[model samples]
Each structure stands twice: as C-alpha cells, then as structure tokens.
Target chain A: MDYTDYYKLTCSEIQKLYRENKASPEQVVDSYLKRIEAVDGKLNAFVKLNRESIDKQLKDLKEKKEKPLYGIPVVIKDNICVRDEETTCASAILKGFKPPYDAAVIERLREAGAILLGKANMDEFAFGSSCETSCYGPTKNPWDLDRIPGGSSGGSAAAVSADEACLGLGSDTGGSIRQPAALCGVVGLKPTYGRVSRYGLIAFASSLDQIGPITKDVRDAALLLNVIGGHDPRDSTSVNAPKPDYTKSLINDIKGLKVAVPKEYFVGGIDKEVSLYIGEAIKTLGSLGAKIGEVSLPHTDYAVSAYYIIAPAEASSNLARFDGVQYGLRSKAAKDSLLEMYNRTRAEGFGSEAKRRVILGTYVLSSGYYDAYYLKALKVRTKIKEDLEAVFKEYDCIVTPTSPTPAFKIGEKKEDPLSMYLSDIFTIPVNLAGIPAISVPCGFTKNGLPVGLQILGKPFDEETLFKAAYAYEQNTEWHKRRPSL
Target chain B: MVSKDNNNKKSEIDVGYVAKLARLALTADEIKRLGKQLNDILGYIGKLNNVDTAKVQPTSHVLPLKNVERTDKVVPSLRIEETLKNAPLKENSFFKVPKVIE
Candidate 1:
C-alpha cells in the first residue's frame, strides 16, 4: 500500500492505524510532510513549516504516548503564536517576528501531544475573506486551484481539505474559519465569543475573534475543541464556562431537535444552487428526526455594515502596536524624528488592506464621527445579536448556507471590495452575535464547488451544533468526497 | 475641510486626516485610491443610521464584561534578554528608538 494513501485517512482512522500498529508516528508524519511538499506549491497553504521541531516533538511524544493527540500533526493559522516560532499573520510588518511565548492553545495542544506543523497562510492580520490579502500569496482552493479557498483561514481549511494535515486551528473574527472550511470541503467550527482563549491569537477584532478547529470531519473538530476549549487564567476575556466533552455530542440522534432556517439568510443575491443545496441539507436534518422551519433575523442586512465599522474600529486600536517598535520589521529612515520613524516604518510594513482598515477605523473612531458611525454600529450590533437570540429562544440551532456562494474565481471579486464583503453576508452576523457556528460539507455545485451548511447554536452550546452537523454529515456522502488534487 | 457630522452623511470623511491619526504615511496615490474605497465602504456603513437604535444599549463585547481580578503578587516573567529578543532594536534591556527629544 502506498504511503500517499495515508494522507487520505481521517484523524480517527489514523489513530486506529496507530492502535493497530499498522503505522508509526514517524511514518505518518513523513507521509504528511511528503504530501505537503508535493501539493503545497499549488495551494500555498502553509507559511512556515516547523521541520526543525518535528523530530523533537515526535521524540517527546514517545515519553507520553497516552496524550489524546499524541503524534497528530495539526496546522495552525499564522496568527496563533507558537513559542520561538515566527508568527507573521502573513503580514510583512510582522515578518521575522518570533514570539517568546506560546499561545494558550499551543500550550494545550503540546500538552495533548499534538505535533504542530508550520503556520498556515492567512489574510494579512485576517483583514480579508479571500486570503488574497496575505503577503504570502493566496491559498488556492484544493477543489479548484484557479479559485480561492474562502478565507482568512483559507490556508488552514485548504490544508485539512487537501489532507496535508490531520487537523487545523483557525481564528474566526467573522467567517474566516467556517467560510474557508465550506469552500474547501471540510468542517470548520467557530466557537462562541470567549469560548476559546485568545491570548496568543493576533487580534483582528478583540470582541469578534475566536480560535476554533478546522478538520476533515465533525468528530475531529469536536476532538480538537475538547482539547483546546475552557478557561485560561492568562486571557482575561476567556469565559469561565465549563468545557463539556464535545465528543459526547457526536450522538447520531438529532431526533426531536428544533432547527430554524433564518429567512434573512435565504434572501436574494445568494446563489440559486447554493440555496438548493442548503434546502436539501435542512431536509436531511428533518429526515434525521429533527424539526426544521423558517425564522427571521430582521436586522440581518445591517450586520455587515455594523461589522465593517466595529471590526475596523477595534482593529485600528489593536493594530496601533505595529509601529515598528518592539518587534517585527523596522524600516531604515536616516532622519529620526521618532514620529517619522513610526510613519515610515508603518508605511513600509503594512499592506494596502491593513492600511485601509486602520485608516477606516481611525475615521470612525475619530471624535467627530465616533457617535455617528462607531457608536451607531455598536447599537446595530445589539440589534443583530438580539435578532439571533430571539430566534435561538425558539430554536435549538439555526441553519443556513455557510457562504452566499461557493468558492469563486481568484480575481472575481478583487475589483470590487464591497462585493467581496458581501460574500460574507450570511456568515458575518454569526460573529457579530457572538454565537457558535459550524460549517459542514453539504453538497457540491454543478461546477463541483462544495457547499457549506452553516449550523449556528446559542452561545456556548456547541454541543447542539455538533450533534446536528454530525447527524447530517453521517447521513450524507458529502464530507467523504475528496478534492482530486 | 472636514466637519463633525451629526448625521451619518458622507461629510467629507478625510482619509488623509484619518490616515495621520492612524500614524500611517500613505502615499498620495494610496491616499487617493484608499480615500475612494473608504468612502464607498462608509456609504454602505451608512445603513446603520437607518436602524432605530433609539433606546438600545450598544454591545461592545458580546459577552458581559467583568473585571478579572488577581492577587497583586508578582510572578516569574521572561528574562530581560528573552523579552528583548524580538525587539528590532535594543540597547541593554531597553528598546532603542530614534531620538525622541529634539
């Protein structure tokens, strides 16, 4: 049997191989490394590989093979810090910056014996959805190389979809995780706000970002979540909620579960085929003994506007730290007014999109515009969240098309940023509402692009999302279909 | 000249002034291109004013905010060298910047 086929094995299947002594950790890691070398040139999924640390991590795992993820190789989005590793967030400004300490999730993953791969590419500071904003280049969809793997977690999703890694950890501010996961034909879970610690994640939006799992299957997502979820004393915003054994939620029974199809999600501009696929997926939920019906999130249209304002406002403040000061790139300026040093350094470091967000954020939060734009957006955020909460009160979870359209051509929306922003119309509200949403492979388009079924649950109730997603995934053949790379 | 906009009108939102506030040295071409793009986005963000948020409390954090208190005891931290390792320029334990005082 070819070792290449080993790349196709899901996380649990690989673990089963380990249990049966059919393959060793060295063989598994070698297969994945080889697969990455063969395909990553086309996909551009990873920014840096921790090749130097692999042998050491594998050797260390032997000492504690009892760990849950012992020897499991996981790719992380570039934004998440790994101790002494370059975490550039695919931005030139942060290039060559090696963090002194590991993020909280990295600590947990290491303790659980997960082998960390090199960091995945992302939209520079996670500012864009198509992954094109990265200085590292865009991650091509494994399904269709000419198209984008939806981002800013595009690289993580593409890596998992293309079987370059057993699993991936991606931070979602809006639809970064789930959108890419859907487009790449994998499972992407965005846990509730503060559900996962953000200590090591390079902040895109303080209130919006949450680190979650992107994997080949639902159970792997739940497995990784169980390992990373729960409180961290290091992160003040980390929720004190009890972390449940998410694997238990994989029960095939969604029987009697109440699911709502939000009317706002099904509105115009959504691709016809995408809507049809989501409808069929909802029917699959009903066939599995779950009750599915339509509900309305009235202020849904205002979500993207609110998000554009709020995220950038927070981003402007959060990114003020990147003034070529303590770390990362420092430009050469002969005349040193200190202020000129800052302006020159920043001018050279940040990409166009980063600069755009910072400037927009500054504009909105500026004294004259603060109450009108920034504060009003915050109020609209309340309205959007209330819309979802009102629906959750009557439903177990909400289901919709993860993205308005499937994977699109690389330069398709690049000409118009507003149109590109609209691609996230469905997924953005979930982030603003700060709820848990999982994107699972529902079906494919006529052009063979995968459709994502977004299942959103009330805050911290990831169990319901897993149960419904798992049931749908188990009953369908969509998740099993691999992209012919 | 940019004026304080009481209404969410496209009140000459100066990308140049805002760029200065953001501490970015954007080129003239960038300022022009980014100005147009930002105005286009701001036009869309104008939708927020349509929502009657008359009495609604704004949600800054999705989760309720609470101060996390800890004992003031000092804990072990990164050594000075380790802390300064990532600094682009440093002298001794302090970060080195260009002359701040004229």
Candidate 2:
C-alpha cells in the first residue's frame, strides 16, 4: 500500500496491515507526520502537533506485541483533556491551560495503544456553529480554502478529510461534530447521549454533550465508536450498558428495513441541491428493497428554540466554575470589591459569544422568568423527544439532509446568531432526544462542496444505522472522491 | 397588539427586575440594549403558546433516569497544587479572593 494511503487506510485495513507485518507502528506514525508536515500548512487543520511525545509512544508500542489500535494515529479536539498538552478549547481565555490529567476517553485511547497525534482547533468552548470563534482563527475547508468547514468540530473533520490525521475525536453538542463532518465531506457520528463518558470534555452544554469519532468511512467510525463508547464511574450521567459489536453489523444488508423520511424536514429554506441529493439517496434505498415511508415529527419546529434555551441554561451553570477562582485563566489586577473583580475577570476572559449566552442563560433561569423560559423550554423538549419516540416505534430509521445547506463561507453567519443556530436544525433534535445519528457524504453541490445525508437510529442501535449508512455508501461513489488537497 | 392595563404588571416584566434577579448591574444603556434583545427573542419564543400543550405533562430530562445513585466512594483527586495551578491568585491550597464581608 502507498505510504500516503497508510494515513487514509480503513481502521480494519490498518489493523490487518499491522498484524501481517506489512506495516509497523513506527512506519504508520512516520507516514502521518510527513503528511502533516507537507499538507497541514495549507489545510490549517491542527492547532498543535505533539510529534516528539507521539513518536515516543509509537516506539514503545512497536516494542510491545500487537495491540488494538497498535499503529493507528488519532487526533483529539483541543477542549478534551489530554495530559501535558494545552487544552485551549480554542479560546484566548484558556490559551495556556495544560491539563494535568487525561480525560476518560483519552485514557482509554492511550491504553489501546493509539498514538495521540495532536489537538485540533474548535469553536471557543465548542460554542459556535462555524470554527471562526477560535482564538487561532477559523479552520479553512480543505476542499476549497475560500469556504468554511462546518464547526465546532471543523478542525477535527478538516484534519481527517485532508489526510492530516487518520481519525479524530470530537465533542458534539447541537450538531457540532456531525454538521462539520457533513460540511467537510467526512463521516461523523454523535453517539447516543450518555453512551460515551463526558468526564474530560470541556462543557458546552453538559446535558447535550457527547464525544464521538470523525473518520473517512463508516466502519472506522464504528470501530472507533466501539473503542470509545462505554460507561465510566466518574461520569454520573454515563449509561451502564454493554457495548454492542459496532463493526459486525456494518456488512449486513438493508433489505426489508423500514426508513422514515419526516415531512417537516423537507420544508422550505432547505437548499435545493441538498434536498435533491438526499432524495436520490432515499430513492436508491427504496430500489434496494427497503420500505420507505413519510412520518411527521410535529414538534420539530420548536427544536431550535428549545435547544437554545436548554443548552445555554445548562452552559451558564457548567461555566460558572471558571470564575477566575478554581481553574483556567484569571484576571490580573486586584479590585476594591469582589463583585467588581468577578465582572472584570469574566469580561476579559470569556469571548463575545460566551458572554452573550451566559447573560441570556442567566436571564432565562433567573427567579421570575425560570417558569416562563427555562421550564417552558424543558416542557417543549419533552414533547420533542416524545415525537421522535412515536415515530421510531413505526420506522426503523429516520433520514434527512444533515445540514440545510453546504459549507458556507467563514464569516457568513457570524454576525447573526439566530441564523447560525438554524444551521443545526435537523441535527439538534437527535441530540435532544439522545439518539444515535451519523452524517455520511451523499453528493457534492454545484460549487463542489459536500452535502450529507443524516441517518438517525433508535437509542443504542448504532449497529443498524451503520449497516444502512454503509449500504448507501456502497451504492454511491461519493465516498471515493477526495478533496484535491 | 395586546393593550397594557394599569394593573398589567404581570404582562410587563421590567428589565430592571430581571437584571437584579440575575445579579447583573446594568447601566441605563446596557439595560436598554438587553431589553430590546430580550423582547425580540421572547417574542419569537412566544410562538410556542400557539401549540396545544395544556394536556401535556412537563418533561425535564429526555432519558428515563431515576435513582442514578453512585457508590459514594471517594476517588482520588488531582493534586491540589496541580488543580489550583491555573488559578489567577491562590495561597495555602485555597483560591484567594477579596473579602466578601468586611
């Protein structure tokens, strides 16, 4: 296999190569380093590359016998804690905050012999839909430098798409991972909430958060999911359940499966190209002997509204810890009063988006308006979850265009927060309902940007979702096309 | 548009009250800005009133979790110095802050 292809090979292929001695751990690591050196400047995908430490780990792994992920290199979002590396979360406030301990997921990845490549840039506190909020600046799309890679996982997706890293770990809240993956033309999965441990992910909205894999193909996503998805005693919210064999079901045929296409998803404002490509994929599934039907998630229109309230409300609480007291950056000067110091520290530390949300969240959750806003949104959220549960009972899977449109220019929606929130309209409800959803590249737009078809499955049924997505991928040539990086 | 009655204090939630409850000491200009922004956002959210939610019970959490009881065992924590290393000001294993009650 070509050494460049070593960086793009499927997880299973890499494992086979390592087992058969056709490739060694050091060679695989070396291949990715050279690729990063050669191409990363143009892509701007990585915020930090720990070449020396990762090489040391690879040398140690090579000395030992074969292990799971023995030679595989994986990149992590900058927000997720990896000991000794700066976990900036792409914010100036956290510029030099090196974590002293590994996040729960990082420990697992390290134990599995996976090489920690580096930290990928993200939206500050994983807040923005586009990666433009980063203190380092926006991560440009590898396919077209002028366009943006969908964010807050944009760097993670861009790195994988540009072949700078084999696979990347990203946190998804309100479609952060899947939307960017769709926009960047890669596979991104938001595992069922609580399916993966959230002990180390810097909080965006604690309730909606999940750590998942972004990769080039479905099976690698499944394999990474298998490695990362499991309960941790440290995380109180983790689900105590056995992990299913995610890779075993990827090859299963989708004949006679019931797929639901919600009518509300096909409404106005969805780009014509996205709708057309997703419609073609649906028709292709129908031709392959699967039963397709129209279903209504009537409460979906309220999803974006409900998401903003709950996510920010939870965010305001989760972020209160960074009060210039316990961790992260602190203000420099002393003040006469504690309150004045608090305000000054916060005003200087947090970015614009973070401050705006904190103010809104605090207002909504305050004494008088708690029942009017936060409580009411939570009630609406219940109905939204119920709506999906009702539909899932009748259909095995739900399909929709992953994003309303293709990757937009970097600064297009930055000024208008409402418009930016609408970008994740289709993907937010899945996170709200805590279901497994994956974004797979379906087709390219007229401008040559990738459009994705989102496939959502019942809770913990990632196996079935992967089978259908893999089947759809097999019928089309979209996954074979690579960005001319 | 709904008319404001002399006794319509319930419908007219003042920004000052909201700010005070939120512990935000806003200036006149800040309050005006927040007032307009909140009104616009609240108007958009007001659309939810059109739905027939009278019969529905309020739902707080999506997952049907109950008794998420942990073992209550103490796990090892990061070294106090390491954890507090990022603090802006610290002394004697505690985060240093100005006196609150003096």
Candidate 3:
C-alpha cells in the first residue's frame, strides 16, 4: 500500500495494516509528518511537531507487544502535557515551557501503543471560541481555507480533518472540542466531566474541562476514548467508576432509542442551512427507528451566560499559578520591584482575550459582587443541569446543532467578543451540565462547510451517545466525505 | 451593589482594580478597550438574573464524590532539578524572583 493511502486510514484501519505487516509505524509516522509539512503550512494546524519524540516512539514500538491503537499516530492539544515536550497551550505566556511529566491521557495512549504526532495550536489558554486568538496565528478550516475552524481546540480538529494525524486529543471546556470538530467536519466527543482524568490538561475551567478524541469518524473516537477515558489518581475529580470498553457501543443499531430535539436549540439566530441539515439528520434518525420528540429545555437561554461566568471564574483561579517565578515566560522589564515584576510578567505574557477573561473572572468573584454574578451563575448552572436531567428522564439522548452556523471567515467574529462567545452556545450547555456530548458531521452547507449534529447523553452514559452517533453515522455518507486540501 | 445602569461606570474602575488583583499590568489603551469588552460581556451575562434560583443549590461539581483523598504515603515525585527546569529564572534548585521586603 502507498504511504499516501496510510494518511487516509482510520485508527482501526491502521491497526489492521499493522496486524497484516502491510505498514510499519515508522512509515506511517513519516507519511503523516510529510503530510503535515506539506499542508500544515496552509492550515497552521500544529503548534509544535515532536519529530524526535515521534521517531523515538516509533523505534520503541518494535519492542512492545500487540495492543489497542498499535502503530496509530495521534495528535494532542497543546494544553495537554507530554514529558519534556513543549505544552504551550497556544499561549505566549507558556512559551518554551516543557512539562516534567506526561499527562494521564498521554500515558494511556503510549501504553496502548499510539505514537505522539505533535501538539496542535489552540486559542491561547483556551479562552476564545475561535482559533484566531492563538499566539500561533489562527488555524484555517481545511474545507475552506479562508474560514476559521471553530476553536480553542481548532488546531486539533483541523489536524484530524486534514488528516495531519489519525486521532487528535482535545480538551473541551465549553465546547472547545465539539465546536471545532463541527466546523472542521470530524467527530469530536467530550466525555462526561471527570470521566477522563485531567492530570496534565492546562486548566481552563477545572470543573468543565474534559479531554476527548477528535477523529475522522465515530468509531475512531470510541477507540481513542477507550484508551484515554478512565480514572486517574492524580486528578482529584477523576470519577472512580468502572471504565467500559467503548468499542462495544459502536454497534449500529438505534432501534427503539428515545431521542429528544430540544425546541430551545432551534428557535432563533441559527443559520438556515445549519437548521436544515439538523432537521434532515433528525428525520434520518427517526427513519432508523429511533423515536424522536421535541422537548423544551427552558433554561437554555441562560446557559451561555452561566458558562461565561463559571468558566472564567475558574480560569482566574487556575491561571494564577502561571506567575513568572515558577515557569513559563517572565518579563525582564519589572526587575525593580516584585509587585511590578508580577504585574508585568502576566500582562506581557498573556494575550488580549486571556487578560479580558481574567479581569471578568476576578470582578465576578470579587467582594459584594459574588452573589449577583458568580454565585448566581452557579445557581443558574444548577437550573440548566436540572433542565437536561428532566429531558433525559424520558429520552436516551438529546440532539442539537453543534454550532449555530458553519465556519465563518477567519476575521468575521474576532472583533466582537460577544458574537464569538455565541459560537459555542449549542455546545456550552453540555459542559455547564457536565454531561457527555459528541459532535458528528451531519451535512454540508451550500458553501460546502460541514454542519455538526450534536448528540448529548446522561453523565457517564457515553455508551448511549456512542450508540446513537454511530447509528446515525452509519446511515449517512457525511463521515466519509473528506475536505479536499 | 452596582446597579445595571451604573454597571458601565463601575466597569471603568473595576477593570483597573481587577487587573491589579490579577497582577496584570495594563496600558491605558488596553485598559480602555478591555473595560468596554468586559462591560459588554458582563452585560450579556446579566441575563442570568432572570432565573429564580432561591430553591436551587449551587453546583460546585456535578459528581457525587467528595474529598477524594489518597493514602499519606511518600511516592516518587519529580526531581527538584526537573521541577525547576521550566522556571524562567532559577537559583540552585529555587525559583528566583525579584527582591521582596527590601
């Protein structure tokens, strides 16, 4: 088989090739490296390519016994640490910072025989909805080079969509993974919060952030999640629950499954084309014997507002550790006074969006305002969670459009922060509710940009989400369509 | 309590104060621009006020587990040299910082 054909193979297919001795892990890594070198210049998908580490992993594979994900190449979001590799979180503040230890997910991937391909770019500190805020310039959508790939996990999504790597791991805090996966035309899943360990994921929102897989198709998402989604002692919030073999949920049968289409999600401001695709997807699911009904999640209007408050408030506290004394970029201009040094180091290191969120977070959590803002947001968050739980009582899964629209032009929403925040409106509620959600390509717009159908399930019931998503995916040709780069 | 109408005025001063608390130095232009952006975002989030959460408990975490403590055992951890390797300025296994309490 040609090396070019290797780039097009899914994780399962690659494993099959390895079993047959048709391709070596070295050749697969070389093919992807060459593809990244050829196409990443245009897509800007990868922030730092770990060439030496990848070569070392390839050599190490010769001594390892057969394992799941054997010989498959995987890309990790820049925020997730890999020992001795630069995990910048796509921020200038964390530039040149190499972690001394590997993230829990990285350890799992290595144990499963997956080679680390590279670190993909992202919104600095995962603060923005679009990839445009990266210290490394924005990653372009593979389908339409001029459009922005939906983000903070945009680079990971773009890399998987462009086949720069077989599978990409992305941390979704308020739709970072799913939104970009929607825009980039790939499968992105956010496991139930705490389902996957957050040991080395650079904190964006500790309660909300989840590391999941971005892949060319749903089965690959399941395969990658099977390896990475489990309990870890390092993350205190890691759920001490039995980890199931996610691959078993890939059965393409959704007969008699109850699916809910939330009326609030489709009400207004959604692009006509996106709504049309979602409508078609719903009908297709119904055709497959899944009973679909309209349900109302009344507090959906408050989800975005609540998410912004909670995520940033957590971010403010989490990001405090980035003070120059410990690690990362430090400002040389404030050598006069310690206070001046602390101030200058942070201001110079962080980007505009990071600064904005920190200020907002600090203000909301400040004295006298805590009740009206931070505390109130938390209360509203409970209401949103209740809303989803009520629907899930009768429905196995809730489906919605992953994003309001298809990929917009790169600079379209950069100037308007509120508009940019709206990009994650559909995906944010799942995070605020801390439920499992997966975004799968449903259809394309007239301009050929992909539209995502989001399937959300009860917490720790990712098996149900995989079942629903896999059924719909098998019935459609959307997942097979690749972006012509 | 900052009123909704006075929120914009409060934001002007609040942005500066919050930046100070965050230990982030902001130039006059950045402060001015960020003040407006923060105000805009805060105003949008003001929609959360509509919900009546008098009976609802604040959810710090969705999971049922509490106080996930491990056994107090000494384990092999990162070496001191490895821990300080990423520090921008270091002095013999210690992170170097600007002089304080001078």
Candidate 4:
C-alpha cells in the first residue's frame, strides 16, 4: 500500500489491516515517522518524536493481536505523561522533566496496544488559546500556515488533521480539545468531567480538566474513548459510574433527538460566516429528523467570566508544585536564598500567559478579595450549571458554533489577552457545566478555514453526544475533507 | 443591578501585591504590561457582579463526591534514589535547600 494511504487510514481501519496481516505495526509506524519528518518542519505539531520507543513497542506488539487499539499510532498532548518520556507541558520550567509513571490514559492505551507516536506541542501549561505560547515556538495551522490551530491542544488537533497520527489524546481545561479540533477540521471530544481519570495528567484546573480524544472521525473518537474512559481508584475525582460501549452509540439515526440552539450563543460578536454555517448545520440536523429549536441559557454571558476566575484560581493552587526544587528547571541565580530561588525559578520558568494567570489567580484567591472575585465566580459558575441543567431537562442536546470565528492569524490575538480568552467563549460553558461535548467539522469559510458545530450533552451522557454528532457527521462531507499541507 | 462603584474598585487590582502573593518576581516592564492586561480581564469578568448571586452556593466541584478516602494502609512508595532523582540539589538522600538561618 502507498504510504499516503497508510497514513490516511483511521484507527479502526488500521486495526483491520493489522488483523488481516496485510500491514505490520512496524510499517505503520515507519510511515507515520516519515510523514512527521516531512510535514512537521512546516507544521511544528510534535515536540518530541518517539522513534526508538515506538520501534520497541512495535517489536513487542508483534507478539499480541487481541487488543482493540493494537498497532495504531497515537499522538498525545504534552501534558499527558508517557512514562520515562519527556512530558514537558510546553513550558520552560519542565523542559527536561520525564515523568517516572505513565498517565492512566497512557497506561490504558499501552495495554490496548496503541503505539505512542510522540508528544504534541501545546500552549505553555495549557494556559493560552493558541499554540503560539509554547516555549518551543508556535504550531502553525496545517490549513493555513500563517494561522493558528486553536489551542492549547493545537498540536494534537493539527496532527490528527494533517494525518500525522491516527488519533490524539488532549486535556481540555476550557475548550482546549474541542476548539482546536474545530480549527484543525477534525473531531475532538471533551468527555464529562471525571468520566476519564486524571491520574498523571499535569493539572491545569483540577475540576475542569478532562483528557479526551481528537480523532480523524467520530467513529475513531468513540473507539479511542472506549479504551481510555473508565473509573480509576487513583483519581479521586473519577466518577464510579458504569462505562458504556461508546461504539454502540455511533448509529447514524437522530430521528427523535432534541437539539437546542441557545439564543445567547448566536448573539452579537459572532462572525457572520460562522453563524451562517452553524445555522445551516442546524437546518441539516433538522432535515435529518432531529427536533431543533432555539432555547434560552440566561447566564450564558457569564460563563467566560466565571471560567476565568475558577480555572485560574485552581491553576494557581495546582501549579504551586513546580518550585524548581524537584522535577523541573531550577534557577542558578538564587543559590544563596530559598525565597529568591522560588521567586526566580517561577518567574523565569513560566511564560507570559502562565505568569498572567498565576498572578490573576493569586489575586482572586487572596485575602479580602476572595469573597468578591473567587467566591463570586463560583456562585456564578453554579448559576451557569443550573442554567444548563434546566435546559437539559427539556432538550437532549445543545448545538452551537464551536468558535465564534475560524482560525485567526498566528499573532493576531497573542498580544491581547482578553481577545485570546474570548476564543473559547462558545466551548467554555460546557466545561463549567461538567458535561460532555464534541466539536465536529461542519463547514468552511470563504477563506478556506473550517468551522465546527458543537454538540453538548448532559454529564456522563457522551452516548447521546456521539449519537447526535455521528448523525450530523454521516450526513455531511466536512469530516472527510483534509488540508493540503 | 450591582453598583458601578463596587465594580470599579474591584477592577483596580494591585499587580505588585498579587505578584508578591504568587511568589513571582517580575521586572518593572512586566508589572506594567501585566497590570494593564489584568485590569482588562478583570473588567470583562466584572460583568459577573451584575448577576444576583445572593442565594447561590459556590460550586467547587461539579460532581457531588466529597471526602474521597482510601483505607489507611501502608503502601510502597518511590525508592529514595528515585524520589531524589529529579531534585536540583540534594545531599545525603535529602533535597537540599539554601540555608534558612545563620
């Protein structure tokens, strides 16, 4: 088979090939490595390529053929640790840090025989909306080299979109997975909070972070999710709920599905073209016999505000572990004083966005101001969750544009922090509500950039999300389109 | 509606004091740049004050789980050498920090 054909095969397709003995895992890995070498210089998607480790894993996998993800090469976000590999979260602080243990998802993928392709780049510590904030430099959107693939999961999405890997695992704090998937023209799912374990994921915001799949298509997303989703005793926040066979939910029928389009999401500030695409997508779903109507999420406007407060406050606490004393970069200038060492190491270690968030987080959670900022944000968060819960009682799913606009130019929003935060406006509320959501390519703009139509379902009801998303995907050709890079 | 005075006062965040609390040493330039950026973000988030959250409870975790605990039992931990492997400075199997007292 041609190398391009090999690289283009989905996870299940590759698994079928492996089962038939028509393709060896070594051949698949070789094709991907060659593709990454030829394309990554222009895409900058991967931070560290696992050529030697993949070879070793391929040799071991030749002996076992029963696993579901056998011989499928998968890219992982930098934040998800793959034991003994450099697991830097694209930050200078963790430049050479190699985790001694694998993340729970990585462990599951290995047990299922998925070969680790490499670690993809991300915004430093998952702090930015674009992958441009990485210490290693920006990951350009494969669709257009001058634009950004929405981030902090940009590399993972871009890799899947560009066929650099069959699938990718990325952590979503606030639209980190879904937004990037939208821009990169791939399918990305942020599973319900706690539906997937967070054992070894480098924490961004403890309550909001969930590692999920970015895949070439919806079926692959479900297939990957089947392997990675379940309860783990190690992650206390992990829900002790029954895991469903996600692939069974990938039926193409949404005959009686109820999908709501929140009026607030379509209000001012949305790009006209994006709104048009999403409107057409709603019509398409309606044409497919799904009940679609406009619903009101009264507190939708406050979601971004509440997320900024809550996520950063949690981040300030979670990131306190990186003090240069253990497991990361330490400053040489503070040899004489521990206080200086702590301050200098952090100041020099973190990037601008990380620093901005840390400072904002500290201020919000500080004495006297806690009740006003941090506590108030939490109250608003509860209100936002309540708003969604009330809507869910009457609607099975909510549909909206994944991003207000398509992928922006690389440096467009980098200097403007507020504008950068707005990129996640449509996707942030799902995280705040702790529900499952998927971003599937719905259409493209006149500039040839892709737009994603987001499908959000109730907490732990990813099956419903998959059903609805799969229905829309099967009826459209958007998911089949690939960038020319 | 919430009073504008409260929102205005809240937006006047002290970047220097916040940086001190965060244990981050910033240059004068960064402080100036970050101050403007933080104020801009705070101004946007200030819209939350418009909502009447007087009776709302703050949600720390979305799930209802609380006090998750495991049985109190001893378990093997990272070996001493392994634990000390990533430490930037160490002495006699212990992480070494700068001297704190004379």
State the C-alpha lDDT per candidate.
0.90, 0.83, 0.90, 0.91
Please, what are the lDDT tens digits per residue for candidate 4 over residues B20-96? 88889999999999999998898888888899999999998899998998999998877888788778888988998
Q: On residues B1-102, what C-alpha lDDT tens digit does candidate 1 reach at each position?
A: 122555434566687888788888989999889878877887777767778989999999888868888789999998899889989899988999989988
lDDT of 1 by residue, A1-485 (tens): 56667878888888888788788888889999999999999999999999999999988887767778877899999999999889999999998999999999999999999999889988999988899999988999999999999899999999999999999999999899999999999999999998899998989899999999999999999999999999997888898988999999998998899999888888789999999999899888999999888898899999899999899999999999998779998889735778888888899999988998899899889986888888888998999999898988899999989999989999898767888888888889989988999999999999999999999999999999999999998899999999987
For residues A1-485, write the lDDT of model 4, one tens digit per residue: 77546998888889888778898887888888888988999999999998668778988886558988988999999999888899999999998887878999999999999999999999999998889999999999999999999899999999999999999999899999999999999999999999999999999999999999999999999999999999998999999999999999999899989999899999898999999999999999999999987899999999999999999999999889999887798999998988888999999999999999999899888887788888898999899999999989999999999999999999999999999999899999999989999999999999999999999999999999999999899999999999997
Clashes in model 3: which pairs? none
Residue pairs clashing in model 4 are none
- lDDT, candidate 2, A198-295, per-residue tens: 99888888779999999999988988888888999778788998898887888748999999999999999999999999999999989887899999
Alpha-carbon runs more than 4 Å astray in model 3:
B1-13
lDDT of 2 at A337: 69
lDDT of 4 at A98: 79
When summed lDDT is taken over every stretch of 10 residues in candidate 3 chain B, the lowest stretch is B1-10
Q: Which stretches of candidate 1 lie over 4 Å from their true place?
A: B1-9
Docking class of 4: medium
DockQ (C-alpha based) per candidate is 0.71, 0.40, 0.71, 0.71
Better of 1 and 2 by TM-score: 1
Candidate 1 displacement at residue B3 in angstroms: 9.2
Candidate 4 — what's its lDDT? 0.91
Error of 2 at A417 (Å): 0.7
TM-score of each: 0.98, 0.94, 0.98, 0.98
For candidate 4, what is the DockQ?
A: 0.71
